[model samples]
Target: MELPYFITWSKQKAPTTLELSKNSPHAFHIVEGSTYRPHLKKIVDLSSMSYQASFGLRNKMITEAIKKQMSLFSIALPKHTFDLKKEVSLRLIEKAKRYSPQTGKLSKDYKCFYTLSGSEGIENALKMARQLTGKNIILARKKSYHGATMGALSVTGDWRNDEHLLPRQWTVRIPGPEEDPKGEGIERIILKHGSNKIAAFCLETITGGNGVYIPHPLYYKKIQSLANKYKIKIIMDEVVCAVYRTGPFFGIDHYPFLKPDFIVCAKAISGGFFPIGCVLVCNKLSKRYDDKILSCGLTHYAHPLGLSAIKATLDLTEQRSFQKHADEILMILTEFARDLSFRGFKVRHIGHLMAIEIQDKLTIESLIENGIYASIIRENLILAPHLNTPIRLLKSSLKTLNKLLSK
Candidate 1:
């Protein structure tokens, strides 16, 4: 996909590498400027776009604030994502959206719901749950992150931050079947707490980004049955797994019979642009969601730019077969994971994902210096390469890792 615009700074120099690093989103050097800034006021600045600026840097407010407040001087923003000399976020967003055909996976009723940022969407979903059911306490599984927003962190499963890092809301964390709860049942927990205080239950479809840990058989269906029996609403958080990252658009597609009240999704939405996450409410929940201002609003709510990206993404998804993409990815990851497992590594995978706990392995910092920039998930490196990135790249990455490990 063509980027929205091009850069034309006279002092611009070519870059050495396409891969972005922390200091430099891309490798570049400066050409001698014809003139010099005599003072701080004369510095030129830029944003994502490569436009002329009067400030000497981009995102100076943040950089200067951090430098003075934190007492540290550093470059965190890359010229591409951050410190570019122009305001081209919209261009970056559009380019990102078009760069990948499949933005996200969705449930049956989606492709019609409004998308918002992750925290924004989660808060709205919870608000809807609160208003419709009139239940004060929201239950979520432990070790999950809805978002960083006020109301979102409330229902977030992780308690490490809730006590001081977030606001106090009527939130409860329910142990999943894996947590080894006291009883052999979720029904027991519901019966003990009673459904009157609990408005809704939210959990990821496959526990992605949280470990890609999937629940056992009849897990969701049982949850659905319990909610029905107790008159509580069920919401599935498919945000991480909603994109084509997992085998299906919506991981909950594996559990349609569960008939969740709401599905919150966003990752890979617009292929990482537009920050378009949505809570796809069901027919029943839709009727209950009403004319109030939604109790949650962001300046970028349904922003035209994001909506445009989403519409284009969805259109591309329909035109392109993301399922095929998922299938191919699954096959590749499965083979790679199986090979790792065959070598005595504790390899586990779901869909096109894999997380292995290989001990006495190579460290994170060394791998990068070796030119392998992988998302280090503890001892396991998270490898979800872009679909457009060639299979050779994946193979080369794995081969390089294996070589490094051999040393």
Candidate 2:
């Protein structure tokens, strides 16, 4: 049967349909920290991949927080009018400050803006950079996935950008680590494009959808030097890497020497409860909008429910036990990847985010039969289970994956 709605990125209906359980309309029901189909097939879901269920499904704290806010008010427009928005914004600012490299105490030097998704955050960041520098060109790397929106897609370097190629007039594509291992391609692009015309150098701290490509520290060092020399603002896209996905509050936290002008994040911050994204701007740039009418606003900009979810999610991330469990999961994935490599599998992982290279085309049916449901990006299998997945369950899932890959 054909569905009424169109699915993004798919030419036809999915190969399998998950029947929602009788108790819940949602397809994948959560039980004891694991997701399962209605038919009782325990799905080892490594598919959420830090974007959907960073804190796992049906979290009591996040649910209660959102519910509490819902009881009061669901939507409040013109953020400044509401006290709850201010409170949550302050809390979020403080959390972002903890991960800042430049005098973490500079709370006055930063401002936060809320959006609907990571792409919205990227769009806002680009606007701010362009407005501040009075330039239109954006420097982005190839094989990068920033967002799906027009402005976001404009700076995006992946094949998804091919669909709307005309919006990329102001974007200059640079070589990724895979193309130019030495990382000199960025400087070349910057010089060719003329640094004065470029407003910002936007990129993921660690590449997400294209592939989990972690750059060498030297790559960042060079980038930092060039940005500083050319006066180009740095925008770090943390859509898939923020909220403890990479063993830190933010992926850029791993690179201490690099100070980004704007940090765009979403994903895990939602706690799988509300769709929200934000851009943290350095005071130097944000302050420009203090008196001037810097145009950018969303009707649902600071929805009370989304703020509640973010507050609860941040609270959970702050817990010592939560951090410890994430560390343990990282260790487990690291060891597992090491073993897989010994068997001729090429694996790249940072924290719990991993990508396994495969020669043969692996299908969703094969994965479901093996008692696992994971994401396949081209030829790479993306393994990103929730941070709070049960230890035994995680181990069992890895074992199942190994067996399936072996055959």
Model 1, 262-309: lDDT tens per residue? 777665555444455666666556654455444545454444444444
What would the TM-score be for candidate 2 when compared with the true structure?
0.91
Model 1 spans with C-alpha error above 4 angstroms: 1-115, 159-169, 180-183, 290-293, 319-325, 359-362, 405-407
TM-score of each: 0.68, 0.91
Q: Candidate 2's residue-wise lDDT over 208-284, tens digit each?
A: 76778988778888888998899999899999988877777889778877778999988888766799888989888
Model 2, which residues run further than 4 Å from truth?
13-17, 22-40, 98-108
User: Would you list the C-alpha lDDT of every candidate in the order shown?
Assistant: 0.54, 0.80
For model 2, what is the alpha-carbon lDDT of residue 308?
A: 89
| Clash count in backbone of candidate 2 | 0
Error of 1 at 311 (Å): 2.4
